[model samples]
Target: MNEAIALMKRHRSIRRYKSEAIPLEHVRLAVEAGQAASTSSAIQSYCVIHVTDGLKRKKLAELTGPQEQVRRAGAFFVVCGDTRRHRLLCAREGRAYEARMEAFLLAVIDATLFAQNMALALESQGYGVCYIGGLRSQLFEVERVLTPPEGVYPLFGMCAGVADESPMERPRLGAEAVLFENKYPDDESMLGMIEAYDERYARYIERREGAGRGWSGSMTKKFAEARRVDVGEYYRSKGADFS
Candidate 1:
């Protein structure tokens, strides 16, 4: 495999981090990498808030289910989908800013791509990063804390630092399962592939001796219980039509 492909394949989310501070140059490079990602219409509808305040980080950690990784990481960033900039531009040009569902979706995708680029850059620089999906747990509170102006919404948080320990590679779906041909395939074959994947994942977890829970069982339990509730209201408040 090529060097870049090898790096991409080996990429993993790192939670535990050493106490050392990340270099300033590396941080700048990571931000540059984020900016270098492709954007829709050259609008650059995204913003990255480089968070350094300890108190704010702790508060964000609390909002994100008190995840220790958020607090322990040397740096934290809140990536946002920012339509406010274009909205302002539209106002200056005497045009209406269409802040619709499709627009928001595009902005969210742009922000995610930027975040992934930054993650890859950090990894290349020997820094570890873990995305905080739980940042959406208390979305409204997070927005309030981050204080992004109207038309900007938080997509996710990323924590980065020198890793204290390595993590085991997580399993991914086989190419046969995910990569379909020109058209959609039959469900029976897909279901069979999924079953095989679940068994493979279960065996891998068992070998690690860590939780030992199968993928199907764990996923079923997670969805069946359904603890997440605040996200809906939060999205609605942000003027997103969730209906």
Candidate 2:
């Protein structure tokens, strides 16, 4: 395989890390890589806050369901979609600042692209990274941690450091399963693909014996016992428009 393909295939989320600090230069490179991602209308509506304070890290750990790896990582960064900058610019220019869903979507897309670029750059530099989606579990608390103003939303958190050990890469569904041509495929074919994927995933777990639960069984149990709540209220409080 080509080097890019090999690097993409070898990428895995690393949660555990050794007790070491990343060099300042590497951190700068990773941030620069993130900034290099394409943005909508040249409005780079994203910001990254690097958190290295121990107390802040501990608070983040608590907010993110006590994820120990977050506290142990060499650096933690919060990627946010910020419309506040544009709003301020409009104010200075005597223009109305209308925050629309499209604007919010653009900001989110820009921020996510930046985060992915940063992840790839870090991986290329022999570092490991894990995206902490659990940051959304208590999104309001995260906003307070970052002290973001209105119109700025915390999209996700990333923890980066040198990996203490290598972990197996999880398998992805076959292209036939996910890639739909000109039109969407029928459910029968999709269902068959899902079953095959579940079997493959089950076999992987069986071999590792790490989390003996099979994919289908675990997914069923998760949704069956999960409770639905209005977490969007938190986002609304932060001036996000979910309407």
Candidate 3:
């Protein structure tokens, strides 16, 4: 594999980080690389906030499932989908900016692309990084802290620093399970692939966590009931329009 590809494949989420701080210049360069990611209609509808305040980091760590990595990482960043800038542009030009489902979708995709690019860039520089989706667990509480504008909302958080530990890369589904030819595979073929992966994943879980709960079982339990159901309301509060 090529160097970049190998680097990507070696990706692991590092939770334990050293106290050493990453240079602000390095973080800026990584974010600049993130800006090079493709955006929808060149909208570039995303913003990153580096949380430097010690108090705020502790609060955010509490709000996000008490994930100490948020507080301990050398740098913490909140990635948000921002349509507020476009709204401001519209106001400047006397044009009405409409918030539609398409706008919301575009912003989300653009933000995700930007974040992944940033993560890759940081990892390439030998910094360990982890994404914090737990921010969504208490989105409203997070808002009270971050105070994003009406047209912007936090999608996730990220932590970056020198790693204190090197963890094995987690297992992933094989290409046969996820990749498709020109057409989608039949249900039986898909289920067979999943069953095979489940067995492999169970072994990995046993080795890693001392338990063997299969992937499907965990997924089923996790999704059996809707989580963060108020997320739609949270988005609506941010003035996102699905219509």
Candidate 4:
């Protein structure tokens, strides 16, 4: 295998970390690596804010709910999908700024790519990392704390530091389940594979994370809730005018 693929295969969602400070040079280099990721149409519509203040980090921990990793990690970053700056640029150039769903999606895609690239870069350098999706749970609180403009909002938060524990590689469904030649696989075949994966993943979680819930079980429990907790209105409030 090529060195890059081998490095990628070693990825783990690290939560626990050593309590040492990360060097400023390493943090700066990681951000540079994030910028190296592919961007949609060269728009590069993303921004990353490193959270260094102890009080702010603690508040962020509250915003994230039970994910204490944000408060404990050596470094934390708030990655954002940003189009406000681009809109200002357009205004300065006497052009109309695009503010549709397509534009919003592109910015969010760029932000995710940047964040994943940063994770890969940090992992390659022996740093452990964990992504905090809980930041979206209380979008308005996050918005208030970050003070993002009308066209910008926090996508997710990330924490990185030296490893305190080694996690096992999780299992994935084989190519038969996910990969297809030309057309999508038959429904029966897909369902069978997914069912098999659920059982396997359940065992994996029980063995690894001590969580008995498997993939489908875990997913079902989350989705079976009668009410949805997503912040669609909040996104709309952030100037997203979707079709």
TM per candidate: 0.93, 0.92, 0.98, 0.94
Clashes of each: 0, 0, 0, 0
Candidate 1 regions with alpha-carbon error over 4 angstroms: 225-227, 241-243
Per residue, candidate 1 scores C-alpha lDDT tens digits across 1-243 of 998888898888898988787887899999899999999888788898988888889899899988988888978989888888888899999998766777888888999989999999999998899999889888878887888777778888999999988878889878998888897769889878888889889878987785567677877888997675876667657656533
Off by over 4 Å in 4: 209-211, 226-230
Error of 3 at 2 (Å): 0.4
Most accurate candidate by TM-score: 3
C-alpha lDDT of all candidate models, in order: 0.85, 0.84, 0.93, 0.87
RMSD of 4: 1.7
Across residues 154-206, which tens digit of lDDT does each residue of candidate 2 receive?
A: 87899999998788878778788878889888888888888888888887887
Tens-place lDDT digits, model 4, residues 167-238: 888888877887788999888888889898888888888897687676877778888884326577888898
Query: What lDDT is reached at residue 114 by model 2?
Result: 91
What are the candidates' C-alpha RMSDs?
A: 1.8, 1.9, 0.8, 1.7
Candidate 3: clashing pairs of residues: none
